[model samples]
Structure formats: C-alpha cells, structure tokens
Target: MSICILYYKMFMFYSLCLYFLSLYLLNLDFTLYLELNILTLNSISIEMIVYFDWMSLMFMSFVFFISSLIMNYSEEYMMDDKKLKRFIYLMVMFVFSMMLVIMSPNLISILLGWDGLGLVSYILVIYYQNVKSYNAGMLTALSNRVGDAAILMSIAWMFDMGSWSFLNYIDYFLMNKEMIWVASFIILASFTKSAQIPFSSWLPAAMAAPTPVSSLVHSSTLVTAGVYLLFRFSDLFSENFMSFILYISLLTMFMAGLGANFEFDLKKIIALSTLSQLGMMLVIFSLGDKMLAFFHLLIHALFKALLFMCAGFIIHNIMNCQDIRFMGSLISYLPVTCSCFNISNLALCGLPFLSGFYSKDLIAEILSMQFMNFIIYALFFISVGLTVAYSMRLSYYVLLGDFNMMSLNFLKEEKNQMLKSMMILVFLVIFKGSVLIWLMFPTPYFIVMPFYMKIMTLLMIFAGILLGYEFSQIKFYYQNKSLKFYHYSMFFSNMWNMPILSTLGVSPYFLTLGQLYLTKMDYGWMEYYGSKNLFFLVKFSSQLFQSFSHNHLKIFMGIFFFFFFFLILSFF
Candidate 1:
C-alpha cells in the first residue's frame, strides 16, 4: 500500500480506538479531585485534576462525540478534493486540539490548546487561498488573536495572584475583588471567539471555505470555544460581572437575530443564527447556573452540527449554491437532506417536542429567573420571536418553494455522500437529547416544566413563523436609475484630501530624515568628517570598536549593560 493510504488507515484505526476508549472511560465511576498542587512550580508532575465532574463531563463528551462524527463524515466529504492529505492533517490537528482544550487540567494548558485550535481553524478557513478566503482567514485570525490576548492576560493575572492552577484559581476567584475584571476580560475573549455581535462579520465571510470546514468550525468547535470558556470559568465571574455578561448576551442575541433577517446567503443566515445560539448559551452561563448551561451546550452542539451538516449537503450536492434566494424546492429530489434540514431547523426554532425546545425553554426559564421583570422578559420574548422568524425563513426559502435545479448535471454520487452524512447528523439530533437527559438527570421530576411558560413559548414560535412567511411574500423593487445617479453625484466627492497631502508633502520630509539617520548609523564617515580629522585616528579606532560591537557576544553584552543601567537607575 502507498504510504498515504497506510497513514490514513492508521489514523482511522486510532480514532476508532480513542472513541471506544472514551466510551469505556465514561462508564467507569471515576473519582473527582478538587485540590491545589502543593508541589513546587516547574515540576513535571502528572496530576489528575478532574474538572469534568458530571456537568463538565456531559459537555466534553458531547464535543468529542460530535467531533468524531464530523471527522468520519469529512473522509467522504473531501474524498475527491485535491488537497486531501493536507486537509486530513489539519482536520485531525483541529480535533486533537479541541479534545485537549476540553480535557485540559490547567488554565494555561487549556489556553494553549485553544490558541492552537484557533490557528489550525484559520488555515482551514483560508484553505482555498482565493481573495475572499484570504480576507476571511485574516479577519478570523485577527479577531481570534484579540480574544487570545485577552485570555493570556487574564491567565497572567491569575498566576500573578498566586493561583496558577485551575482549582486554586476558582477557589480564590470566588472571593477576590479582582475577579470582576478577570471575568470581564474572559467574557470579552469569549465574545470575540464565539462571533457575538460586532465581532460576527468574519463568520459569514468564512463561508468561502468548504462545507465540511464550515460544519466543523462554525457548528461544533471554533465558534463554540467562547461558550465553553465561560462554562469552564463560571465560578470566577462575580455577580456584578454576571449582570453585565447578561446584557452583552442579550445584545448579541438581538443583533444576531436582526442580522440573520437581512442575510441572503444560506450560510450567512446559519452563521448569524450560530451567533444567536451562542448568545443564548452565554445567557445561560451568566445566570450562574452551571447545570443549565451545560445542558444547553450539549443540546446546541448536536442540533447546530446537524443543521450545518444538512446545509452543507444542500450547498455541496443538491443546488451547488449558498444563497437562499437561489435555492428552491429540494424536498422531492433531496428528501433525506430536506427532512434533516427541517428537523434541525425546528430544533433551532425551539419548536415543541424537539431537542431544541427543551434546552432553549430551559434557557428562557433561567433568564426569567435572573431578570424577573417585564422589560427584560419582553425583550427576551422578542429575541426569541426573531429566532423563530429566521429559522423558518431558512426552511421555507430552501425547501418549500418551487423546484429550481439550476443544473441537471449536479453530481449524484456527491449527493449520496452528502445525504449519508446528513442522516448521521439527523439521527444524533433526534436522540442525543434523550440520551443527555437520561445520563444527566434520570428522573421524571428532574424534567419538569411549567405549563404556562411552555404554552407561551410555543405560541411565540408559531407567531414568528407566521410573520416570517407573510414577510417573505411581500415584494419590493429597486431602480437602476438611483444607482446611476449616486455614481455620478459622489464619484469624486469623498476623496481623501488629507492622505493625498500627506503623501505629497509631509511624508517626504519624514522619509528624508529617516534616510539621514540610516546613513549616519550605517557608516562612521560623517562623524569623522565632522571632527575634521582632529580625532581621525580615534574615529578610525571607533570604527574598529563598532565592528567588534556588531559581534553577537558584544551585542548581548551591550543589551545586558543597557538593562542593568536602567535597573540601577530605577531603583535609585
């Protein structure tokens, strides 16, 4: 067998082994450890600090399980792509980084894994290397870097405060006044990583990547990093900070809902909805209710992954288009894809009797408890309404309209692969919630819901769908005359006069000054000539000194001298 084939087979076998190993480990009654490391710093100790109690275990398992499915699906999804080897390498790296992040024992280790995953995801996002993909990669990288810096700073602060370990930090953070700032910094990090609100633009741009990349990064791993961070550090956030976190969550939820309405591209719509769902997860976390947030994360991952996978099937196979406006009735021709998409959409809309309904309803209930007032409650209600609108709009525009197969030659084999992947996702979306409930809370009383709240939520979803369908039917037209008029009227009106002047005038002076400095620095001739050869011999000797100073050892000594001088002066 070829080396590549052997490598691929070995990787598949390893992944299968890990999956079964994780399952077996989950069944064992592992003991929990919540203690600080008393050993000295820099010791290479292997301590098993169990952060994955029942709650964290639930989310971690979900992440790993879904990631395995996506990885399996990708084997077929990218079977024909030219860069299959590079693709598999990055994909496996991404999955491994996520696993490390979820199971990390220390904050520093987790952040390291998180940043590694972010880097790999950027590579995957810009894998195509076209102009649009390049821009998307840069944007995602810059935004994620900002988040990474925040997290690094927070970690530094924690270590400086004598809490180098996760358990130690949590215990200290619960009562520390500085925790408010730390928590705020962490939330900022999460917001950027999760693509919440103003940071959300890059996510839609990221759709230039392949559909499988979108499914894995947007749905399951990269975008969800922030939410996972918040859940991991819930104890660190003070109540005061939690209030602000709640407001940020609400703002992101509302803005994402609005953006989704205005988006025409199908992936963009799903991207916006991802932001909205993440915001909801933030809301649950901000309530200081770990169990509820954990549950929400589990349900969100399954359904969102399913939704993205189905969308991928449609875009990759059925229509070969990512714009909702261009797609029409795929129900008859791609029934499996349509059915999977519909179920996932319903879950996203929080329709009754679906997995999304249970988890989202729990979030709403927590919000009500946290706010307990008319204004906040009503705002959440409206946001939930918008969620339903976009979710239904997505379903209606793509699946229910008149059939429009743009080309009859769309690949049937690819369509079959897409359908098979969607079926796997669909099965998970249908049953994962029940499994979660069984494993986490295995009693009837534990799953109780208030009757009136359920009814109101159901009504809200129905009303939003009704409004969305009605809104879709109304047509509006734009005149080409307006575009021509704007082009003529403002073509030269907004030119950058200041930049033009700077280039013509100010920049030349600075450039000349820079050149003079460089000349003086590069040669000692100016100093020798200025001294009129009075110290010509000394100047020539100085040239020897300069040449010697350029030696690496002498350069190191010079830097050491400079630092030592500064240290002495500061102390004095």
Candidate 2:
C-alpha cells in the first residue's frame, strides 16, 4: 500500500511539472502532431493521428493534475479497505483514459477513451459491492453508453469526410452538405456525457461511488467531457442548433437548482449543484464562447473537487450518514473542513473576489449583454440566484445553527492525508479562476450593458443568500402546507422526475414492445408460418403417402397414371 501510494504521488508531482511546461508551450503558440500512418485502400483513405494544441495540453494537464490529487486522496480514504490497490489502479486507468480523450484528434481513437471512461466509471461506482452501488453503476454506465453509441455513429457518419481527425474541419461541418450528419450526433453525444436535460439522472445516481471518484469524475473530468467536446466543436454548430441547445441547457440548469433545494442528502445536493453548473457551461458553449465555457470548466473543477473532498471528510466523521437533516453546526466541530466547504460553496455561488467571481460573474455579465429573449434573461439571472440560494441553504443546514445529530458524536478534521490533498486545491479554488481567465483570454471582453443590468449579479447573489437562509429555516417536513401540494413539490424535488423518466419511462416502453414482439412475432406468426405449421404439413403429407403405399396405394396410383397417359395420347 505504501509503495502504491508513493508511486501515484510521484506521478502527481510529474504532472504538475508537465502542467507548467504545457503553459509555456501555450504561450509560444506551439502545436505538435504525430502521425502513425495514412492507409489508402481503393478510393477510401483512413488517417490515424494524434494532435496536440494549447487547449488539449491545457485540458489534459488539468485532468492529470486533479486525477493525480484524487489518487492521493483515495490512498488514505481507502486505506481501511482490503482492495485499496484495485481502487488506485482504476483511478490511474481513469486518468489515462481521460488523457487519451484529450490528446486523440481522431474520432475513432476518442471512442476508445470515451468507452473507457464509461466502463471504468461503472467499476469505480460499484467499488463497494452493494446493491445500491450496483444499481447506480448500471444507470451510470447505460446513460454514458448513449453518448458512446452516438460517438460511434458520429464516427460512421464522418466516413464521408474521409478524416476522423475533424479538428481541421471545424468550419467545414457547417459549410459542407454531406458533413452535417456528423455534427448533430456529436451534439447529442456531448449532451449525454455532460448530463444535459434528458440524460441528467445518471450523474446524481453515480454518487453511489466513493467520494474520491465523485470528486474526480463529477467535479472535474467526466461530466465536463461533453462541455469540452462541444467547446472543441463550437464553430460547427448553426445558430438554430445553438438556440435549441441553449433552451435545453436552461431547463437543465433550472431543474437542477430546483432539485438541490428539495434534496436532503448531503452529497446529492452537491451533485445536483454540479448538474446546475454543467448546464450553465452548456449555455456558454452553445452561445459560441468556448473560451468562456472552458474557463468556467477549469475553475468549477477546482472548487467542486474541493467541495467533494470536504463532504467526504464530513461523511467520514458522521460515520457515512449523508442526510444533511441530521447535520448542523459542523463548523463548530470540524473547522478546517467546514471552512473549505463554505469557500467552495461561495465560489459556486460566484461570490465576488473569490475564485468563482472571475468566471461565473463574467458569465452572468456576458449573458446579460446578449440580445436574448425575456425567458433566457430570466432563467440565467434566476439560476444565478439559485446558485447562491442553494449555497446559503447548504451553509445553514450543514455549517451553521444548532447541532442536529441524533446521537452524541465527536467529529474532527484531523484526516491529514485527505486534508493535505484538499489544501492543494484550496489554493487553486481561490486563485485558479483569476489565473485561468488571464491565460485563456489574451483579449478582454467588451461588455456594453445598462447599469441595472451590470448590478444584476449583486442582486442575484444577495437575493439568493437571503432566500436560501430563510428557506433553510422552514420545517419543510413538519409543515402541513407542504403536504397539501405533494405533486408539485415532488415535481421539483425529483427534478421533474427526470430520473424516473430517463430510467423507467424509457426502459418500460421498450420492454413492453419487446414483450409484444416476443408474443406476436417470435412466438406466434413467425413460428407458425416459418417452422411449426410447415413441419406439421410436411409430416401429415408424409404420413398420408406412407399409409397409401402400405395399403396397395402404389397399384392404384400406377393404374390412375396409365389411364391418364392413354387419355392424353388419344387427345394428342
């Protein structure tokens, strides 16, 4: 165990060095590509290649950096378990797969990494070997397979272009008549991976995985892949497609925010919060600002990872009880963990001067400047407030107020190994936003909006804090009024039953059709005409012939044939 831990730590340090080197190369505007072979058979040609650019290097470096940290955290988190080595190996594989996705320019190669993510995630998710874990893993894997299949189909469609490395064809997609099919599949693929709208359930369910996996996959890498994919292909989408994507993203953001408020579990609240941010990123990408979305993506990764780590520590202290209703005044017990948690939460809410302010605040300002409909304007602003609102509510329930634990317990933040990993990100969570925004955007955005529109950010922040705090105080479980509107309450709490719709609604309908096919086609019409009736008719005819032959039927048939032959000869 010690040797394995040291091995990953060694890798983590190297990735850090590589990150700085990548930044330097980005500054130099260098792109390096390595080609394996270009095979041509007949009129068709296949190119196998890997391309490296500033964005790929940067994204890869971040992924390696976070994953390396997660590997370190899991060392201590999984120390009590017998299979810590297996856990470490899976994390390494997960990181390797993400890197593959990052560096691979060819769509075909990207599928390997994409499928690797889904497979490894399912394994990581079911690491504990429990019923819930198994179910969650299934949901997660199946949901991601949707994206995987889309990517495969996209690869097939791109055969018309004769190049799987479509990075060079960014502008070609929109211009060419034959290439439009590839773009749509890519969009849908990105949607599923990013947990947009219809594909959002798997993400929260995947929280059944260990917290380390959750931090690494949900906070930083896995969920962001969709956003990253679309970011790379931002130029490919038409305005109409962008508009449709934006509306879907808006619904996703709103649904997640609403779900978070009603959620009682500790980790799931953060998961839902992650979902909301993903939606926000989707909006930015669809609006044709990949750089902005990328900026948010990295910053969100830092703080969200920290958020999950802190939650993990808390859950550890509470002996795996994740219900936030049983949690309160944690700051009084675990000050360091509580502080880190709150900072991440505030960052998530886009608190001014914190890490979130630079990117998230910028997103809000940019959205305000856009010539969008009233609904877009409302959802964006309201979603901003909801961000703060959930943060405040989380604070009220978990960090502030009276102790709510049912039993006497001693909780402390002395898990140095885990805390060490978290502290590394604490610095990033505070500074990464400011640093990344500068690095990514050489030129500044020119925002032209009214003073009222400018202050819309502060309005949302303050309103969210106030509303979140007040709402957190309500005895939601005790109030009779809550019972009076179970359906509407459930609609929001269940994120409009997206989980049910995505899981049950989809499967049951298909299953029913499958049953019908089995009863009517497989068991009925095809069986009768194709095999059963044919066999019965052949057997009956054979039996009739045997009976005639045995009972002097041959002599009778010979006599009839001779009579028919004589009649035909006379006619001729």
Candidate 3:
C-alpha cells in the first residue's frame, strides 16, 4: 500500500477508537446514575466515589470531538509523508494521553498522562529529524520538563500533607499554608506549557515541525493543556492568588501581542498569537469565574485552530514558504482558504459579532470589575491595540497583496492534499458552533459592554489594518553594517533574551561536572589522594586492627551480627 493509504487507514483506526471511547464515557455516566439508584433502593452499604464532574465531562467531550476532526483532517494533511505510520501512532498516543489527563482521578494519574503527552509531542516535533526540527523538539521537551517537575513537586507536597485523591484533597490543598509554593509551581507549569512570557520562545521554534503538527500542537489542542490544568485547579488558586495571576497574565498578553506584531514567519506569528490568546484566557481563569473561562476556552480553541490551519494552507498551498514577506494575492488563487483565513483573522481580532468578540469581551468585563488600578486597565487597552495590529498584519500579508504567481503555482502543483485538508478546517472555522457550542456560565457581575465601547474596539482593529498597510508600503534600504546590526539587535532584544540566557546559563553546569570527572581520570586524583603517606599509614593501622578482629571472616560474621542485632531489636 502507498504511504497515503496507510496513513488514512491508521487515521480511520484512531477515529474508531475515539468513537468507542466517547461512547464508553457516555455509558459510564449512565451506569453511575444506575448504580446510585440501586444503592438508594437496596440501602446497601456501598462505599464509592465519583470524580467525574461537569468540567471534566465538558473538556473530555471537546477533546474527543476535536481529536476526531484533526485526525480525519490529517488523512489528507499527512498523506505523502514518509513516516506516515509513526505519525499516526504518535497522534493516537497524544490523544489517548490527553484523554487520560482529563479523566484522571488523582494527581499521580494526571502527571502520568501529562508526561506521556509531552514525550509523544516532542517525538512528533522532531519527526523529520532535521537539525532545526531536532532543536525545536529539544526546546519543547526542556520547557515541558521544567513544567513537569513543578507539577510533580506540587503533587508530592500535597501527598506529604496526607491527601492523594484530587477530588477530595483540592480544598485542603488550597487552604493549606504551604499552598503558596504549590500555586507558584502550578504557575510555572502553566507558563511553560502555555508558552507564556519567558517560555514563549520554544513555541515559535516549534514551527519546524509539519504543518499538521504545528496546527495541532502549537495552536489547537496540546498547548492548551497548561490552561486546562490551571482551569481544573482554579478553585485551589482563585481565592488568594487571583490578583497576582491577573497581573502576570496581563503582562504575558501584552508581550505576546508585541512579539506577534514583530514576527514575520507565518507559523511563528500564529504561535505567538496563540500564546497571547492563551494569556488572555488565563486572565479569565484568574477571575474566579468558571463560566467565562470555560466559554473562552471553547471559542479560543475553535478560532485559533482555524487560524493555524488557514496559515498552514497558505504556507503549503499558496506561498510555498513560511515567510509572510514571500506571500501575496493568494485570495484569487485559493479563494476558499483565503475566505476562511479572513474570517478566522477577524475572529482573532475580536471583531464584533464573531466568536472572539464575545469571549474576549467577557474577559475584559471581568478584568474591569476585578481591577481598580488604571495602569492595568491601560495595559489592557494597549494589548487590544496590539492584538489588532498583529491579526490585521497577518491577514493583509497573506491574502491581500500583489500576486506572486511563481510561488502560487509551485504550491498548487505540489500540495493539493494539504489544501483539501485546510479547506475542511476552514469550513469548520466558519461554522464552529455545529461542532462545539459555547456554554455561558454564571458570573457575579453582568458582562455587557456599552455599544460605544464595542464600536471603539472594532475601530481599533480597522485602524490597525490601515496602519499595517501604510507600513508595508514604505521602502527602506539596509546599506550599512552598523545600521543592520543595530536593527537586528534591537529586534531580538525586544523579542526577549530570557530564553537564550536560560539555555546558556543551564548548559555549563552539566558540562562542568563531566569535565571535572574527565580531569580526575587523567590525573589519577582519587588514587593520589588515597595513596598519600598519611592516608597509607592510616589504612595500614586500620587493616592491622581489622586482622586482629578476625577480618578474613568479617563478611560472614558481619551478616550474622546484623541478623542477631535485628532479632534482639525486634524483641525489644
């Protein structure tokens, strides 16, 4: 069989597995109700616990549905890849691990699933085994490991306090005095997984992976795992830490928005945008408002996934390159992809009447209520402007420029299947409600904004687009080396150098120990120290004392002595 056929067959198998898993979960819920009734009627002494709740049920349902669609779409997206079987296997493993993560009853089980997902994602990121791909994979794995360690430490701390089951221990964990450490660790995990602030660099690098992997991991499902963790543990951190979370989230949103505006790579732009959006979602999560957070999560997943898939189509079918500068006038050639791309871009810009508008407005409303400080409000306003800037920049660059026929023809000839898969995702992007519905949860305050405020927000997006167009038209020449160096350095500095510093700072310790061991081997340092005159005299005296104590039989005598000592100690 051809690789494409094999890939489709494997995807079909995963779809079947997901279908059965969803059905089983549904049945499990029904069986729980039946058992509850049986126990009530019989008055039986049954000690049982139920961990599945509304949140878990909702998240799991979404996971299954989205995974099914992505896998189905992958039948086309990954058709021609040589490692098709391995791709399918890793994708299945990723979904299965995510399912387990949502359904886990305890912290240990959740960690197990979390690590499994991270491992499989890393492998998938480096599936091509190119240098850039390997580096991206390594960065993702390292960042994830930092998060995983935090999670494990938090779980251990909780267990040490005598609570193991998450359902039962969550309240206790929250109220404990040591919960500050736990919350910090949880924040670390969330920041790394969601690619917020300092950890944001790895996500852009993750673009080296395939378009499907980039769409699935960076944009849609996997990266959101961190937000899911925070949402799941919202109760534990909300009461005392909500304000701190809000500030941190706002900073992440602002920085990410700025970063996205400056990025030129198509996938990197979306990746940075996703980070910013996730940060916005984190703000919602920090509001102690479950309903708003849940709705935002749903809508963000739908539209962001749509945007990434559209970007993938542009990269694979319209531009034949990752750089947006090389793309132009793709709307005429790839009308369907372009249309979907525009709608998703509009949604991302939080244009009124779209999914992003409702969710983002909800978050803004909650923030306005919680934050009395004007600085934070101003930051929020500026972030709104930045969001407009980046989203419009992305849309204008890819769809509304002069046609580059050579590039367009190359993509059309080479990757028709990718275009087909993107078209399916585009359709979903336009009418996402059919696949997933946003449920509005109750909030303490009314989340309605005035008509004028909505108008102003929409105007900001338009103004951003106009500004981006004007900026794109300006021509500048880089003739001097100093000028080029200054511009490049400023760009990287603004993008943040924390990722670089962390990488370099952490690498030397591992090398230093290895070098020290090699130096000892070369110099015979250990033997030299032991064989010195003072050490030899001490060794001779000790050996003489041991011989006087019948050292030849010391091994057998020592075992017997230990056994007798244990026997006597046991009786005592």
Backbone clashes under 3 angstroms, per model: 0, 0, 0
**If scored against the real structure, what TM-score would every candidate get?**
0.76, 0.89, 0.79
Task: Write the residue-wise lDDT of candidate 3 on 1-572 in tens digits.
Answer: 64444544555555456445545555454322111221332332222233555555656655554555565556666666776777867876887787667655556667777898789989988988899889889988998899999988987677554443555567776577777787788878888888777787777777787776776675446788888878767767755577877788788888877767666788887887787888788777776766667667767776777677777666656435787777777776777777878888887777766767777766676666564578887777678778888777777777886664564275442455545555655555555532333322322345565676545555666777776665455322223546664476346424566557566767799899888876785446665665565688898999987876776587678879999999999998
Model 2 stretches with alpha carbons more than 4 Å out: 1-4, 38-40, 478-482, 517-572
Local error of candidate 2 at 188, Å? 0.2
Who wins the lDDT comparison? 2
lDDT of each residue in 459-486, candidate 2, tens digit only: 8889998989876876465356547555
lDDT against true structure, model 1: 0.70
TM-score of 2: 0.89
RMSD of each: 11.8, 5.6, 10.6
Runs of candidate 3 with Cα error greater than 4 angstroms are: 1-50, 161-163, 238-240, 318-320, 404-408, 411-424, 433-438, 441-456, 474-494, 520-524, 527-572
Cα deviation of 202, candidate 2, in Å: 1.2
Ranking by lDDT: 2, 1, 3
Candidate 3 Cα deviation (angstroms), residue 169: 2.0
Residue 36, model 2: lDDT of 78
lDDT of 1 by residue, 1-572 (tens): 53334544554455455545444545674535564454545533333354544444444555555655666566666777787878877877887777667665576667777898789978998888898888778777877887889888877776665444565567767777776667777888888888765566666667777777787776667887778877777777767777787777777787777667656678878877887888787777767766666677778787888888877767767546776776777776677778888999888887765788777876776665553567667767788998998887777788887655556646343444456556766776877677665665554323344787646676778878986786455312212546653343222211212113323444589788888886785346765566546577788999888988679697889989999999999998
Weakest lDDT window of 10 consecutive positions for candidate 1: 490-499
